[model samples]
Structures are given as structure tokens and as C-alpha cells.
Target: MSETTPQNPVFPHPAATLILLRDGPDGLEVLVMERHAGLRFAPGATVFPGGRLEAADHHPLWRAHWPEGEPPADLAHRVAALRECVEECGLLPTCAPLSSAVLADLRRGLAAGEGFAAALARVGVAPALDRMTVLARWITPEMLPRRFDTLFFLVMAPRGQEPVCDGGEAVGVLWATPRRLLAEEESGRRRLVFATRMTLLRLAGCADMAAALACAAVPGQGLPAPILPRLVETAAGPVFRIPAGCGFLPLETSAQTVRLG
Candidate 1:
């Protein structure tokens, strides 16, 4: 469905995405992929690896795979994030190191319709869910026909593993510092949706992964409030306005320039 199409509002599907980060020679770098231009949602926009949650993500079997602590309210979101990361980018965050050959085989299995949990079981590994940190939560504006309540998770990229775009949902993948990405967007070399642009702006404040994680884990800093942008008509044109003090500066943008899927 077209995001701009006005229809009866529906509950936003729960979704999760991973923001893979690492310390590059220049500084902090994040992994992003270009969605296939033919896709129904967020077509051709640069985005983190993610998708709507699946039934498998919430299966009780997952209880054996996560950590020991009281499971977070968003534990299933983290599971979905890791699963999507593997499906879209060919990277797995496991509790133990996996050989490149094993990773490739798992990717092939997933492509051939293997369930994520089953694949993990075959490999005798569990997802390193403890490594993930909540970054942000956003709900698609109600004006859109298709909407998602998506959680953004941050984690350091697992060492000894490389990312490969699946060439279907994700057509290309790259690692670049947030500043570089923002610069590319400014030059029109890349297309970033409103949430992605704002996310990058937030990440741009950190010099490296450690700082970013520390910022996310500050004491008593609870999960961020869900941000639901509003579409407003100004004399200039339509613009999307997010609430103030959401950590993203200059909270308004021309609607024509923002991709809402």
C-alpha cells in the first residue's frame, strides 16, 4: 500500500531493526543497506536491517535461547532484530564465534526457507541478545495506510564476520560514519527516510562505539518515549513535525522530502 494513501487507521505492526556499529579508522561507522527499489515499503531508501516481527520470533522455544535475567519487555524485538540482520545482511550475533563457512551455510539455509531458531539450533549457538541496547522507538504517523511500531537496537558488529546484502530486500550494503552518511544525503547521493536521518543525527554526536553505548545506557535513563510525527501544512508546504526534546534537533522537515514508509 502507498504510504501517502489515506485509509482507516490500523494498528501498527511491531518491527525491529539493528544498528550495527564499529570503530573505523576515521571513527564510528554504522552498517546500512539500500532497500530494493521494487519493494512495497521504503523502496530504495537507505535503512538498517529490519522487518516486521514473525510468529517464530515469539515462540516459547526462544526462552531457552535468551539470557538468564528477567526478559525485557522487548526481548522478542531483539530476537527479530538479530534474525532480520541475518536474513538481510548475512551477519549473525551469536554467543560464540562461528567460522565463515558456517555463516555462509546458515545464510544459504535461511535463503532456502530455514527458520531462524532452527538454524541457530542446528549450529548449537544462541543469539547474544545481551549485547543489544535500545536506541529508539518510533511509530509511523497515523496518516499513512501502512504503519509500523519499530524499535531500533544498537550493537557492536561481531568480529570475524562480514556483511553481504541478500540482493533481494536489500540490494546493497555499506559501512560509513554517520557524518559521512549525512553528508551524502546532503549531496543527494543517498536517500534517508525521516527516522533514519534523525537517527543518524543522533549518532553523529558520538565519536565512537563506546560513547554511543554509554549514552544509550546512562543511569536511570528509561526507554525513550515513542515518537509519532505529525503532518502539518504551512504556507510553504506540508511538513512533518516531531515533538521537541526528542534528542533530534530541528524537529521539522518538508513532507515532500521525507519518505514515510
Candidate 2:
């Protein structure tokens, strides 16, 4: 480990990511954004839309927005996922129809320090939190300088809404099948963080959006213990490995090849 690296693991900050899915002519496609190369975390990597959770996401005001029934325990995570989705990419999943103009305004309000709930009220739309389903949870490896306890949520992309990168934190956005993304990584055309690569591997199994959602809905599917990779020295060099029976396919790779932020 570098001398500057902390001897003890830093507390992981709460974070959430949204895997926006859709059925394209080619197959099941996911919306991915390229992080700005200057970012302190996961620079230039291709990843699903997401970010750290904000206090506003946990505000009690959101209870009014739920379509029915009690909000899930992870309501804040879901809200943060949707909030980051809109902040990073110009897409909003809402219970009612939302217009491009309203979305643009909401983005502006967010930029100007408007809370997500207030932004929703400003536009008279409620986030379709129910549409999102848990996919996985990953806590960054303890060896990393920055850490996040990130919950990955899967949701179908809203109809008639397209993603536009914010051009700040995110520089570009595109839709591609999971296999195609992995292929790009293989061909050296793109960079995917280890967690993203693993998540895509799971998504690659599904043939379409319906299949993907069905897999997420399976009983006890995504509620497994949080996956925390460990760094160990190997003959080749340092490597990261996830424990067995973590629900993800076994993953062990050179630490140099993996980027966790």
C-alpha cells in the first residue's frame, strides 16, 4: 500500500446507482455515462447513473409522493438514485407524464440548490420510486482512499424521455447492451470499474427489459449481504477478490486493472 493510504478503512458514505434499462432494436440496453476524467472518483470510467446520497433524499416530505402503501425502508436510497439520475443525466422517472421543458427546469433548480422533493413539487410530478428494484449492494474495498456503500437499483427507462449528460460530472451518455459494453472494455474502447463490470455480467444474462426486471423481482434475489472485495498480494502483484457465495460470479483480478471509488 502507498504510504499515504490510510491504515484503517474509511467509513463508507451512502451512495446509490440507477441501472436504467430499455429494449432496443438490438436487445436489452442500459444507459451509461462517462465520468469526467478530472473527477476524483472513477475518472473517465463508463458507469450507470448514480452518486452519493443527500440528506434531502431522506426527508419525510417524500411520503406524499409514494403512489400507495408504505415506502420501502430503502426509500432514501431510491430517491437518491432518481435524484442523481436527473442530475447526472436529463432523465426522470415519474408517476405522471413529465415534459422536457419541466425536466430542464428541474435540472436548473437542482443546480441552484433545490431539493429533489421541492423540485418534484415545483413540477407537480412524483418520482416512480416503486418502479425501481434492488439489484445489488457493494461497499468499496477497504484499501481504497474513498469508499461508498452503494446500492444499485434497476429500473426501466421512462418512455419519451432521453438521457443527456450534464457535461460536468458526466461528459457523455449512451445506450448499449451489456455484452457490447463488456466487449468494448475488452477491446480497450472504454473503461469500466470492477463493480460495473460485475453488474453488467449479471445484466448480460437477461435477454430483454422484461427478463431483467423479472430477475430482479425474484424472492431474496438482491438482498444478499453487501459485497466487500478484499485486496491481497499475488505472485503477479496485488489483486482484488470477492468472497465466495456473494451471489455474483467469482471475481478475482489484478488490483491494477480494477478501479473502485
Candidate 3:
């Protein structure tokens, strides 16, 4: 192991990521955003919309707006996923009707430090937490300075809801099949972090939105333990090894060698 590699890993902060899906002309498409080049982590790489869970997300006020009966342990993560989806992509999945004006107002409220529940109240909407399908869990390797235990959620894009990148945290957006994204990155036209690469590999198994949703909903599919890669030294270089049979296809190659920002 390298000198910098930790002998004992630090606890990872809890985080969530959203995978927005839609049926495009070709097939099932996933929404991806390019992080700002200046970002401290995952700079200039494509990622799903998500961030760390905050204490504010656990406030009981949010439960009044989140009717989906997700386990309490998962409630904060799901809420955080929804909040990030709206902030980063301008796509809000809610029970109440949402207009451009309402969305604008919600954005303004969010900027003013109003929480998700309060923002939803301004628009007379409740978060459709059921829309989100828990997908997978991944924990950053301990060697990294910053680590996160991230929950991945997948949801179908609401009809007529156009995704607009805010040009801040996210600089650009693309709605493409997982296979296409992998190919583009391999061809050197785009960049992907390790988590994103694994996510795309899993999503590539589905042919369309229905298939994707069905696959995600399959019983016990999302219950595998969080992926924690182990650094292994090799003659070529240091390589991270993810365990085999952890729900997704086994990665035969070292994940550390994968292109990451």
C-alpha cells in the first residue's frame, strides 16, 4: 500500500445519488450532469444528481410532506436525493401540479435556505417519494481524503418536465443510454468517476424504461452490502478490487485504473 493509504478507514459521511430515467427514441435513457471543472471532487466528470445528507433533512416537518413509508433509516437519503434532483436538474417529482412559476418560486425559496418541506408547501405539492427506486449503495475507498457512503436511487422522469442544468454545480447535461455513455468515455470524449462507471454498467442491462424499472424493483436486488473497494498493489500500479457477486456484474479488471476526474 502507498504511504498515504490509511491503516484504518475513517467513517464515511452519508450521501445519496439520483438516477433519472426516461424513454427516448432509441431506448432507456439516464440523465447525467457534468460537474463544474473547478469542483473539489469528481471535477469535470459526469455524475448523477446527489449530495450529502444534512441534519435538516431529518426534521420531522419533512415527514408530513413525504408520504411514501420508506424506512426511517432511508428517509433522509431519499429526501436528499429528491432535493438534489430538483436543485441540479430542475426536475421535481411531486403529487401536486407544478408550473414554471411554482418551480421558480421553489428555487428561490431553496436559495433562501428554506427547507424541502417549506418549498413544497409554497407550491402545494408533496414529494412523491415512491417514485424513487432504491438501486445500490457504494462507499468511497478509505484511501481518499473525503469519503462518502452513498445510496443510489432511480426514478422515472416526470412527463413534460424538462431537465435544465443550473450552470453552477452542473455545467452540462446529457440524456443517453448507459452503454453509449460507457462507449463515449472509452473513446476519450467524456470522463466518468468509478461510481458512475459501475452504475452505468448495472443500468446497461436494461433495454428500456419498463425493463429498467422492473429490474430495479426485483426483490432483494438492492439489499447487497455497500461496495467498499480494497486497494491492491500490482506491478503495473495500485488497483482497487471490488468484491464479486455483489448484485452487479463482477468487474474483472481493477477499478482504480478506470478513468476518473
Candidate 4:
């Protein structure tokens, strides 16, 4: 009999995510949207506003929007984050007085495969590269059928802009304190992906927006190398092992076990 060999898992696509934050009545709150149930990736999971980077994101027109002193190496991530934020939440950093009709048209055009820069040009809005800060990078575990090497960016929402879901990729949206959401997840009332859960845990320690931003500013501490978790099979089932001292929240054990929900 011939022996069978196992195949390698599919590689994750490079993607960028933006975590919009603001002060809530209780404490610092982060925006989250529920993925459409029919979507292929992370269906029905709650996630921050973000998506994979598109080639159009690197259009030359975006260069004019780059912030002073910002390195060029990861400009695409910043652009993609901002674009996705606007598309997913109907919020843009640009203060260029756009009519609601114009904004809706831009979103529709962007969603229909139009380049983000071109859409912005049509609406006369400049990208707000300065508003976003790189928070962390996470690579989806190899054990999963789908994966994404995603960059997470943190930014305070533009003043007077309310975040609303597009009703397509995302069906609903809400803002809640990290502590409150984490507790709800623990009680099984809510579902959170591992990365989102860990992020909330870190933010939960912050007393306010300033404290959170201060914590995020610490180099290598807040933005560490891409976190690639390993999968370990156990009697209970598959559990992901997050290594300790990896610059993210330290695992309780030398390696922390997590269910891939």
C-alpha cells in the first residue's frame, strides 16, 4: 500500500485593520462590526473595520496624503486602513464638506471595484494618514483553512462622525468598552476572535483614551513582530498555543492554550 502525505495549509493574504476608539460613559470604547454570515472569512465573527490591501491602494495619488516623517515602507497599510474605515463605517478623516449623496456614491463606487484614491479624488477628500497609529500585527494560524496576515491600526474617530455599518460585509456595529465586551465574551453572551479578545484585554487596562494611546506609543511593546500562533491537538480538541514573552499580552503558561472559535 502507498503511504499518503498531508498537504500544507493555504497562506494568509496581507491585510490591514483599523480599530476606532473613543471615550464612552464608562471608559474607553472600541468599535466593532459583525461580519456577514454568508462571507467566506470569519463569517458571523465580530471584528474591527478592515480588509485586505488592494493594488489600487498604492496609487501615486495617495503619496500626497502621506504624513510628514512617516516611513514609506508601510504606507499601503495606512492607506488601506483609512479606506476600509471609510467604506465600512461611512467615516472619513477628511473634513472636505461632502454631501451625503456624494459620500454614498463614493462608498458605492469604492465597493464596486473602483480605486480608493480615485473615489477620494472624485469627492475631493484627502486621506488622513496621520490619524492612524500602528498597533499590532497578527498572522492567522496555519491550521485554519483561511488566513490573513493583518496589521492593526488604532485611531480616534473623526469628531462628529458616527460609525454605521454598510449592511453588506458587516450587518451591525456597536461601540463598547473593552472590559465590558471581554466580560460578555467570558459569559458566552458574545463571541470574540482571539486577536480581538487579546486587544481588548490590553485596552481594558487603560483608564482613558490618553492612557491607551500612551501605552500604544511604546515601541516594540505595543507593535511587536507578527504573532503566529501554533496549534496543538489535545484530548479536548484543537487548542492554539500563544508563546509567552512575544511582546503581546503574556500567556499564563509558558504557552497559552486557546480555542479557535
Listing every candidate in turn, what is its Cα RMSD in Å to the true structure after a full C-alpha superposition? 3.4, 3.1, 2.8, 4.6
Query: Model 1 TM-score?
Result: 0.92
What would you estimate as the lDDT of candidate 2? Answer: 0.86
lDDT of 4 by residue, 1-261 (tens): 121222696888888998888888898998998888898777777888999988877777666786565445567888888888878888776645556666778888888988888788887777677666777788877767778888888877666667779999889889999998888877877777788877888899988887777766334323357777765555555455566755567443122434343
Would you list the C-alpha lDDT of every candidate in the order shown?
0.86, 0.86, 0.80, 0.75
Report the lDDT tens digits of candidate 3 across residue range 191-230: 8988898888888988898888776634332343788766
Candidate 4, position 103, lDDT: 72
Runs with alpha carbons beyond 4 Å of true place in candidate 1: 1-7, 217-224, 234-237
Ranking by lDDT: 2, 1, 3, 4
lDDT of 1 by residue, 35-57 (tens): 99999888999999999999888
Model 3: colliding residue pairs: none
TM-score of every candidate relative to the true structure: 0.92, 0.91, 0.90, 0.85
List residue ranges in candidate 3 displaced over 4 A: 1-5, 68-72, 217-224, 234-238, 259-261
Weakest lDDT window of 10 consecutive positions for candidate 2: 216-225
Give the distance in Å from residue 72's predicted Cα in candidate 2 to where it truly belongs: 1.3
